[model samples]
Every structure is written in structure tokens, then in C-alpha cells.
Target: MQNLTTKLLAAAALVAVAGCAKKAPEQLPPPPPTETTPAPETSQPTGPVGSTVVPGSKEDFLQQVGSDRVLFATDQYDLSGEARATLDSQAAWLAKYPNVRITIEGHADERGTREYNLALGDRRANSAKNYLATKIDAGRISTVSYGKERPEVAGSDEGAWAQNRRAVTVVITGM
Candidate 1:
């Protein structure tokens, strides 16, 4: 009689548990789509007369100035006529944006020793910086020589060396 009572109690507990179990939630309908306006074009040139779009912007400077770098003659830190012209344009652009600060990176070909190349690169960077100082504030510019450590082109050929020996103007901030 005790076993029969125990079985009945166990069956009642199971029935209660089954009855208390949660049911699955009903599915919700998908949200309706909404219309969106087309985004404005950013690549178009829309600046002052004879100037590129967004004068103080980096993209405008790159497009108007042709390149941010100037190549140097072998073993020389002097600015060539072409380099001077490029820097002239750069100076104009920098003048237009007084808030811009820059770093001049000096580089050299792979022919020289690491220490020698580093020194050469420093001279190259300083040369460019000095020229730019006449145009922009000296305080806004800094210099660093990568030497032969970072070459624009690899290998020891004249072609690669020509590309490697260069000073590059990089916009640091406020542009």
C-alpha cells in the first residue's frame, strides 16, 4: 500500500511539471522597408578658382601638388630646379593652411653604409626643411632621416637608387 501511494505521488508531480512547461512564442512579421536619399559626391573638385577641392584637405594637396616627394641627385642634398618648383607649390599650399604641420623624411640609396646613408639622409631632409622654413614657419616642421633603411624602390640598380634618394613631405596633423 505504501508503494502504491508513492507511485501515485510521483505520477502527480510529473503531470504538474508537464502542465507548467512554457509554450513557444509566436513569429513576428518583418518590418516594412523605408526610402533613403543618395549620398553627396565627395570626389568632385569644388574649391577656389585655380585651386583644388577642399584647399586645406590632404586629398586636395595631393591632387594639386602632383607628389609629396622630391628626388635628389646622387650624393647631393641640394634642391634641383624641379625640386624647387615642386616645393614652391608645396609652400603655397602650406601657406594657405597655416595650421598644418609636417615632417620631412630623408632617404638615401642602398649603395652607402648604414651610418653614412643615415647622415646623408639627414642632410637631405634638412635641405628640404630649410627651404620650406622660408615659406612656412620653422616651428611647424620637423625632420627625420631614414637613410637607406627604408627605400622607395628595392635593389642596387641606378633606377632603384634614383627613386630611393628622396625627401618626402608628410602632413602630420591639422590638414
Candidate 2:
């Protein structure tokens, strides 16, 4: 009789545990919405395609000033007439955006010692900075020399070297 009672109790406990267990439905509900989820039809872009350039942004600067860099002759920091024209456009853009601050990055081709290249880069950056100072506030400009450490193009040929030796005006702070 005691064994019979034990078996009955065990069966009752198993039934209770099985009733407590959750059973999944044949189909699951959809997942929660996420940040990357597409917006509703009302939230779609209305402007012309590629007309979404934000004001005072880097893209706007590039669009307004054609190019941000000026190429230099090998081992020279002086601005050619073409370089000056490019700087003039850059200055015009800066003038339009009064809250902008810029850094002129001087770069050199891989031809000289590291120390010499760095110095040349500094001179190149300064030359561009000084020119921009005449149009924009001198306080808003800064210079950095990467020398041959950061090249736009990497090669031993003149074509690559010509592209690498340049001063690039970058927007450091903006609206």
C-alpha cells in the first residue's frame, strides 16, 4: 500500500510540472523594431537625389571650393599660380562660413630624409596658411606637417610623387 501511494504522488507531481511548462505556438510574432528599420512612406527623402548636402558640412565645403588641396613642385614650398587660385576659392568658402576653423596639412614626396621631409612639409603648410590668413582670420588657422609619412599616392615615379607633394586644407571645426 505504501508503494502504491508513492507511485500516485510521483505521477501527480509530473502532471503538475508538465502543466507549468510553456509550449511555443506554431508561428512566432515578428521581432521588435530596430534603429536600422526602414521609415514609413511619409519619412522618405523629398529633395532631388544627391541634393542632401548639409550646410556648413565637409561636403558643402568640397562642393563650394572644387578642391581642398594644392599641389607643390618637388622640394619646394612656394605656391604656384594654380595653387593660389585654389586657395582663393578655399578662402571664399571660409569667408562664407565664418564659424569654420581649418588646419593646413603639409605633405612631401618620399625623396629625402625623414627630418628634411618634415621640415619641407612644415614650410609647405605654412605657405598655404599664410595665404589664407590674408583672407580669413589668422587665429582660425593652424598647420601640421606629415612630411612623407602620409602620401596621397605611393610610388617611386614622378607621376605619383607629383600627386603626393601637396598642402591640404581641412576643416577642423565647423558649424
Q: Write down the lDDT of every candidate, Cα atoms only.
A: 0.84, 0.85
Worst 10-residue lDDT window, candidate 2: 34-43
Q: After TM-score superposition, what is the CA distance of residue 164 in candidate 2 from its true location, in Å?
A: 0.7
The residue-by-residue lDDT of candidate 1 on 131-153, one tens digit each, is 99998899989999999999898
Query: What lDDT does candidate 2 reach at residue 148?
Result: 97
> Once model 1 is optimally superposed onto the true structure by TM-score, how far is the C-alpha of residue 75 displaced, in angstroms?
0.8
Residue pair clashes in candidate 1:
none
Q: Candidate 1, which segments miss by more than 4 Å at Cα?
A: 1-54
Per-model RMSD to reference: 11.6, 11.2
Which ranges of candidate 2 are over 4 A from the true structure? 1-50, 173-175
Q: After superposition, how far is residue 11 of candidate 2 from its true place, in Å?
A: 56
lDDT of 2 by residue, 101-163 (tens): 788999999999999999999999999999999999989899999999999987999999999
TM-score of candidate 2 on Cα atoms, chains taken together: 0.70
